[model samples]
Target chain A: MIPIKKQYRRLRSLLFALSSVIMFFIFWELIALYSPSPYVPDPYSVLKAFITMLTVGDIDGYTLTWHALVSLERVLLGFIVGAATGVPIGMLLGIKPTLKGAVTPIIEPLRFIPPIAWIPLSIVLLIGLWRYIFLIWIGVFFPVLLDTIAGVKRTSITLIQMAKTFGADNKKIIARVIFPSSLPEIMNGLRVGLGVGWMCIVAAEMIGGEPVGLGRLILKYANLLQIDVVIVGMITIGLIGLTLNYFILLLEKRLFKWRVEIRA
Target chain B: MKKAILLESVSKKYEVGSSSLEVIKSLTFDVNENEFVCIVGPSGCGKTTLLRLVSGLEPPTSGRILIFGDPPDPRKQRFGVIFQEDSLLPWRTVIGNVKFGLELQGYKESEHEKIARTYIELVGLQGFENYYPHQISGGMKKRVAIARALAINPDLILMDEPFADLDAQTRSLMQRELLNIWSKLNKTVLFITHNVEEAVFLAQRVFVLTKRPSRVKQIINIDLPYPRARLSPPFISYRERILTAFHEELEGI
Candidate 1:
């Protein structure tokens, strides 16, 4: 059983979070009441729009769920492709300093350019699903690559020495020692990569190739000046992002149970 | 007895910025098969550098190191080395850590598990085979390190103050345990330490080393039998002799 004081603290934090969310809605409603512009809808109207879009189909005969699913599929595919390519390239660069040095100039410039900046280029060079995948891939790739490199670089020297003493050569040391040691860092990269990939969905869907994504739904409703419908789409995106982030965090905890956090 | 390890005029120097800093100054020694030798020195006296040279982790600036009539090369030779710091892989469990060396040496997975289990039991960590490095105590982690080293069945084992980080009680307990393992296995050991008492208690012969630019100042034979008493007159005298050599080196005498 948890201590009484700890339980009390948990309850208090829960209440604070609930109150904060309630206060945000009240403040938003007040803004809608006093606003001269019709773009800011009240929280209640947005909630109604969400329920209607969930139960009955929207103007495109597709529910909000279908749009969110489309967005999720794009994010998942992009994130997987990013990780598959990033990990091997990152490991190669990490192991060979000369290779990293030669490639750094080119990758450095590309990494700084955001996914949104690549929109026009991707649209012109790619078609349909590939366009969205390319944009999201751009957002996901760099973080995974950088994190994997950091992980490989940060492996304990003592552990490497220990492996060497046991008649392990360079290849064996990398596979057995460096790889396992770098896993926690690699997992962090995947988590960050997924978050960035999800964020790219909006810009990806807005390219006009895909018409059923949450981002497209939001854009369509906004064009018709149905502010409540747009707000509903916005809330759905926020919820999905939160869920995705939390899912990866849970996976990290499960995979690395040996990790001891030195919390004060 | 055959010479398990032979070092002739081994010296190591570091190039720090522009000026060179000498750490080891022409060290020469030999450790025989089944012998337990301890090198005692002041801190930062290149004792670790000596061990590194022996394990072939680093090369000496000059002189030659031979293990069983061959030059020591970690990639080719089977040498067991436990470092001064914690080196057990945190991602691996006790058994997994022990099996790591075996796996790298190309032993089949089915064959290595039993071998790993034997070493785990030998180190008195049988119950904690499934426990990770973080789950075990300092002494236990040290045991896992020992087991990992021993699992490779190396003829020469080098330890760099393996119990230096333990508490006083745990350090002594580990010292006794180490003696037990060393005697039972009958393997050659070249252990490095700063504690004169620890050196006297564990070694068949204690080699006293001086401060930085360190060289072997004295080699005192410890003729006391197994389970040597720390409080005994002979043990105290051996400890004092090594301590005097260290103190004289510190005083520049």
Candidate 2:
């Protein structure tokens, strides 16, 4: 059971957090009231638009939930494919420095070319869903690969030496020691890659005539000068990003329960 | 007694930039079966390098190291090594880390848990089986390292200053615990440390080495019985003899 003082302290912090959020909305509402600009919709109008889009059968071509689900599918598929391929190649590069030295020069220049910049080439070479998947994959691949390589390189020499002394062959050492030790860094890379992949899917949807994604809906409404609908789209993206990040953090905490903060 | 390990004039030289820095020079020693031997030397006198050479983690620049009358090879011979650092895997629990060596050796899946549990209890970590290394104290982590080494049932154990990081009280307590474990297992152990008192307290014989281009300076046999008294005259005399020999090496440098 929590102590009474500790419970009171937690309640106080919660109240403060709630007040801060309330204060932000109040400030936005006041600004909207004084200015009365079409560009800056009041919070009530944005909330109303959000609900209406959720219930209505058509926002652009499909309901808001359908648009979100389509974008989620694209992001998940691209992220999985990118991670599945990137992690193994990264591990290979990490173990074989000579091979890494040969391949790095080519990858270094290509990775710098942003996923959005690949849109023209993707459009020319691919059609429909492949285009979206290609962009998202490009966005997700490099971070995971680079981070995995860095993680492998950072594995403790002492741990490897200890494993060897215990009669572990090279294969066993790599499978048991190197892989598990690099997990924290790999998870961090996945989190970063997920964010980048989500952004790429939204940007790709905006450019392509997807007709069923959140980005497409945002573009359609913005073109018609419906500021409230645009605001609704932005809020949806933010909420989804926040939710996905929260899940990643929860997974990290669960997997890395062994990590503890050292106090001075 | 059968020879558990023999080092014939083993030398280690590391190339730094263009110059070669000799670490161990013409060092030779032998440990008999089930003997607890400690190597004491001035800091940076290649004690760890010697342990690594015997463990076959690194080859000696010159001379030979043998285990049971054959040249040592890590893949073919079973040797457990405890490093100076708390080398427990941060991702695994106490039981998982203890079972690491057995798992690597491809022990039967059914036997792994029983063996790991036995060693965990042997190390007095019965209730901490599920706790991660980070959650345990430094002394406890060292115990886990010992348990991990013992779980494999290796032919010999090489330890490199395994308790140098603990406080004096904890270090003394671990020393006693280690002695108890060593006596019960009857395994050959090659322990390395710079602490003269610790070396005198733990080993049946202490091999003292000179600084820098290190070689055995003196070999002092400790004939004291088990549960040696630190305050007793014989214990103090043994400590003094090792300290004097060690200081002489320091002065020569």
Candidate 3:
């Protein structure tokens, strides 16, 4: 049914997208080579350092893999902790109107404040620097919670009516209707919150004294005036973020196969 | 004749900022077993709301609705409803949507599956049982909704413009298909729609309603044969009377 013109346009768009990304990286690599600056390392130098990190271990102080592993641990711990507490709480707020009314007043303002803003308090209250994970958890919790409630609210009124018309009681309606209806939005919130969590990794590492993480690695290179390694760290973080985002997108597109999008 | 559904002076009101909006006010009707009653009303006439009240989905403001002269209970499993939209659960496979009522009625999983399969096959959705609502076409979804309603085998079925949204061709096909099913099963249907031709085609009797806080204006009986031709003299007369009643609402005001 699709016209060949549309098919050709789609091909053009795909090629355009691929070339744009390829060119961006190629340009960055070229500039690093030709530019004469001690601070800025060329693409080849960065690759050498990357290879060195794999084989030679620590370039500045911490090994590249070492920082990656540590950052991975922190993210996992914080994400798990946030989800463990946040999911149930979101469900409660979503399902029980009384719970929402009582809790919304408290959660509303607290949600507006950034998680990184809590760094100063975390240091004061908990063990110094380790509280960064707690801060990341805080950042992720609100979006997931609010979006969950929003998702529950978005459940169609007709669906509730349909269930009830079929002799479904309150419990049956909630269990069968509200729960599934909220799944898509819950996933959306989780993905958005996670992106925030990853971006906040740098903030977490910077606040907490760490020889690990691309964030802290960059800070180390900045002091040494090795801008190429700094760019490498930035690229590394960007790649990791892209990887995580892609996985979330993949899960969304895969698991919710029932999604029939309104194609433009 | 067996009185299948009875609405005894049933009334429903909505309070909006010190103003009371009465959608159904002391409205009463009785549908005999195997009878087809069509409620024709303009938008916001609470045609759908009345059906919901009869189905036990919504309680009346001051009166009670009864299935077979007793207070209506969804647990009795006597009423089936098809909304304007199919309202099929997007997450559920077509068969799952059809089996919903049976499952609610406490039918065992195996028996439920058997019934669902039979009805989906009857409604021309055998191959689509495994397909989700989003995967199917709108007409197919409507058929599934009809199948879902019929799967319960209720004494009385309430339908609110079930095919109003479909293209004319599909709507005509559905009307014929529904009549075939209704004729065979002898199911009592209280159908609501604004389409005069549809009201004539589907119902044994059409109760036309006035616009804005409507009450029944006329109950025109169609005594023609099954699969009544729209071009018949009596059928056109009935349509004219209903249309005149509707026009009176606009012209008089």
Candidate 4:
């Protein structure tokens, strides 16, 4: 409650974080040195491999940054395409009875089939790079679509009636009230969809090796028995995923501050 | 007095399995300008159904409703409604919730800002303009809902058990504040409640309904003086008459 206590708490948190990093690195490096096999490299050696991947361009051609960039571009493009259509489709289905009934049956079944199942069909239909993009798009679209619809449906009937009584037309009610009210759920869908998209991309990249990506790099190292390099690639993937999720959360906080429940 | 709201032979029905259940039966009433009309009845007596019909939220199965000499056009007639729930927009500040109807009615930004500020102060939320609905107490939220309706300056205000969720202390305060607001604004109010004392306290005329196929059991005019004393002989007599009628109506149901 007091200013002094708040400052002390912040300093304590900073110290705790610093000690955790030091202790974790020390234990990891110490364990790797006396290990029985080459699979578990020392933390220092893994760091060296990470540096080589970044500075000298790992494997044959591309650098670590190159793989991360390529992966980022694919996911971002697929997410944009998926959300651009998914949100409106979801909203339309939720609001209109006839549309919901007709379309929901189709969506209900299609959503259950894993995006991986369409790999062969996608390869048969589309050319090289587009296949991977299509798989990622499919992975993201359904979760986002379903969640958006659920959110719109959950809007309170009283709020709708209130808007209607106050002279809000169908268009104004949808655009102004329902859409903003549904944002928290739509954002939730997008978050889940992105995770599915990430998983789909990794599976596709490893199997197909169609482009420069972390998934492809990890696969390349795994095949060559460079387990440490593979581990490095996987860790980078995790870190990048964390960074992307953090950005989404930041955007959510800024735009939908109302969704954050007031402490009072 | 100028007539603002009128219903003629209005009734509503809903299909129930193999039979049709009629809710409102040949109900007709007129709300004069600046008059406060309270509709009180036993539970499931279609008090809510009548309010919805008047506000054009639900259409009567048979009869027509005319507001201001024309069929009620929701777009042209911006009515304010306070439900049992506060119905405050969760994302908005106290002022934002108050300004919602004004914004939808195309009131200019500056004009609404002034009006919202004035009304927020009126509802005793002067320092809570930036507080979101979730941050406010239940009583505070109710006040904001009241302020929002007032800011819109609707020709009619329909309230359905608006104080039902509030504590007795808060409900009494809200009643006094509501009467003060009614005296100042003079909007035709159609308030629905089941509390006998509440109906007797607030209304010019209390329209009681029968159980199912709810028709007007009786429309009792409160001849008790304004600023009514609760212990007065006339007030108690009117309440006793309504309760006795309610008892007979319940027995029939």
Top TM-score: which candidate number? 1
Expressed as tens digits, the lDDT of each residue in B197-237 for candidate 2 is 89888999999999989898899999999888888999999
In model 2, the runs with Cα more than 4 Å from the true position are A1-4, A30-39, A96-111, A262-264
- Residue pairs in collision within model 3: A32-A42
Q: Candidate 1: lDDT of A60?
A: 76
lDDT of 4 by residue, A84-138 (tens): 8789998998889698998777888988888778888888898766777787888
Better of 2 and 3 by DockQ: 2
True contacts kept of each: 0.92, 0.89, 0.55, 0.74
Ranked by TM-score, the better of candidates 2 and 4 is: 2
True contact recovery of candidate 2: 0.89
- Per-candidate DockQ values are 0.78, 0.78, 0.57, 0.65
Which digits, one per residue and each the tens of the lDDT, describe model 1 over residues B9-31? Answer: 98999999999999998899999
Q: Lowest summed-lDDT stretch of 10 residues in model 2 chain A? A: A255-264
Clash count for each candidate, listed in order shown: 0, 0, 1, 0
Per-model C-alpha lDDT, please?
A: 0.90, 0.89, 0.82, 0.84
| C-alpha lDDT of residue B118 in model 1 | 94
Clashes of 1: 0
Output DockQ, candidate 4.
0.65
Q: Which stretches of model 1 miss by more than 4 angstroms?
A: A1-9, A97-109, A262-264
- Across A4-77, the per-residue lDDT of candidate 3 in tens digits comes to 99999999999999999889879987776677864567677888877776666665556787887777677767
